[model samples]
Target: MMRSHRLFLIAMVAILATVLFRVPAKADYYGEPAELVDRATSVYKGFLADPNLEWFRNNVGSARGILIVPQMLRGGFIIGGSGGRGLLVAQDAATNKWSSPAFYSMGSVSVGFQIGADVSEIILLIMTDRGLDAMLSTDYKIGADVAIAAGPIGGSAKAQTADILAFGRSQGAYGGVSLEGAAISPLVDWNARYYGQPVQIFDILINQKWNNRQADSLRQLLPKPRRNAQPLGR
Candidate 1:
């Protein structure tokens, strides 16, 4: 039991070090937030087209918002770590139109085991107003602020009360993941750079005016929601 606890602590430290030291040193406008928007668009399109993700496709009409993480890496016992940055866009309750994406980073140390590595593309569907509010906040803990669960794959799955439903497509020796205690925070600078002005999550998601032309294609992809929501994805 002590050994397991030690491993978890080590994992958290590695993740913290990487987020603190490695990310900001990048030149080129910190790798350009526009590039992330492009990647997010592709990821969203792929999920919609994937046949294996039937539940997501069928039930997406009920989601209040969607977050797309183009890549999430998990590896190593020592010189390795796990983290990913993503974007969130919510549907306007009044207009029923999708808003522009807001930049966010998500990280977790509790993915995979002591050995091996994996990479995944993840999509999260926010099911309620509370879930959407959490995403709009500067910082959010997955299972603490609201519940989150792995979205079902096949048809037999029933509805879920969780605030967020996560879907991941992974590859590598250690292939699966869980977001139970993951930390998510807004990428404030990235959001400013991406839109050519500083903006808050409320402006980007709720008021729905903080937008960029590059993201229009991505917003156009989301389905229109129903007047009523169902427990399944609503």
Candidate 2:
């Protein structure tokens, strides 16, 4: 009996060791910085141009920027798991150009027996003046710096619009359960250097540099924000 107990203890220790050294899941962004920039630019620029979304985009420069982390980032288990990553770019009050984007990643772990994978998108709203101020600091915690809300889906057109106005996300899945309480935190790259780049999301919409053909394609797709909110006034 004592021998059996000793063997059980050894097995348990081995299992715990495996879990401790578990490999991190890898994600594929397709090695496409241009694609990410283009997609993010479209989202930001589209929000700006849309008559409906302009007020929010205009305010984002002053509003705390949001970080959205997809749940179940890369896949693994050993190789089966879930989580996501996000980034934010803010404009300087004086420069009027985007600062190097602040990148962040968010995720969680579980103890229950579960497996499989899913895709999720995190949308964040930077709602308060203080929240924005906190993000600009060297590093910020998710709950510490910004208020977090776990978003839900489906509603009337007006309700949907209101939901979009706040932070929200869409999740897709496979397996026994879907995880929740999706949270986020800032990603720090100490070696990276950031300078304000002259690029503006506005440039994507109206810049004449694009051939008339491309310019028209972009303009037709991007509409000016309807609310026309001014910068936060003193």
Candidate 3:
């Protein structure tokens, strides 16, 4: 009887130890990193196919980089703030190869926000080196750190000098939306999640230290790299 009791206790302890020491499951692998890129890809395709975006389609090839925000929710929710997740990728100057996409938190808080709500898809063309530099840093504001002008709509619209150009489409009660004064902050954790390791903003965007095959299709959708990424009049 004593021997049997000891054996049963040992078995229970072993089972408990096994349960306590087990390796847990990995984090949600298909979370923001994969899902956001997929959405951005769809938005990019939609923008390219839109007949109203003639200027965008024609001049995008010259951009140094592009920031695509699939859907930015703006309106009266609680108060004074609105934003969405976005991904940014830059073209290497020498190789002209597109870098891995890096996630960014984009939005602005304003006392002037209207009462109605809207969802806006925005793409910002980083037309100059300064604009690209701002994107690699910790944070940058649309109108403050870089000058931004709305991309002209028609095919005949000529390119002008600006640090960045904004292209957007909005659906809701609000008439339209402007990206001016919007702040962009790097989503470093998303990069780590997507790449399977933590990396710096510069490493992801400029140094090109990280690569994820998941983002390959999205990178391929980018406009062909142009020799000159600078603005025309600048």
Candidate 4:
């Protein structure tokens, strides 16, 4: 009887330990910024590899900033939500150089006829100062703060003169994808973790605060700003 009781107690403790260990930590919820940067690099490379994205490649040179969401998940039975984390990089008008990435989270809730889920890679080209300014804010709504248009696909496609242009590469059959009411907010914790200190969006992007060697490769992937061309919204 004594032996059986001891065995039962041991099993209970073992089960409890397993359960506790399986639970993810809070930091795990937000991925490491370095890993996110590498993933963003791959996502951008994938975009460039797509023959249908020639228009994007051509017009990207004119963008004031670029936001890359490597993997955004969306699903719903009726009332659904979509959310994801991404990196945003801006171009310095004076020096024609790209800035360090600013981390952000985007989420939205919708009520409609939606059933299935889809995973997609999203890219937003900030076409004007207005669009870039809105993204630099602490929190901003997509369509309300800055106008967003679906990016044109294919070689001969021409993008419209909008504040922002959005492109998506979906993995599953989602009926439709929209950024109409989505909210974008800065991820301060992730930025702090990456930079080893608390930093503001303006400090990292505009003022050029800390620098990480890991970002050198990623910065090289961006389109170089034209020296003769004037900055947008000048």
| Best model per TM-score | 4
lDDT of 3 by residue, 1-234 (tens): 999999998996775444323211111122567898998999889888887777788778778789988777665522445678889998886787888898888877767524555567888888888888888778888888677787777666777688788888876221123678888999878878889888898888888988999998998888675565555423
Winner of 2 and 4 under lDDT = 4
RMSD (CA, angstroms), candidate 1: 6.2
For residues 54-168, write the lDDT of model 1, one tens digit per residue: 6787878788889888887666644445678888988877788888888888876653346556667888889889888888777788888687888876656656667899888
Worst 10 residues of 3 by lDDT: 20-29
Assess every candidate by TM-score.
Answer: 0.81, 0.47, 0.80, 0.82
Clash tally for model 3: 0
Error of 1 at 7 (Å): 23
Write the candidate numbers in order of decreasing TM-score.
4, 1, 3, 2
Q: Indicate the residue-level lDDT of 175 in model 4.
A: 17
User: Which one is best on lDDT?
Assistant: 4
lDDT at residue 81 of model 4 (Cα atoms): 61
**Against the true structure, candidate 4 has what lDDT?**
0.78
Model 2 TM-score relative to the real fold:
0.47
Lowest lDDT sum, 10 consecutive residues, model 4, at 19-28
Tens-place lDDT digits, model 2, residues 1-69: 999999998997776555444423333242333333344445444334444433344444443234433
lDDT per residue as tens, model 4, 1-234: 999999998996775454333321211244588988998999888887788888787778788889998877676554556778899988887777888898998877777866666667889988898998899888899988567788888777755667888889887221123688889999999989888999989988887876777888889989886566543332
TM-score for candidate 1: 0.81
Clashing pairs in 4: none
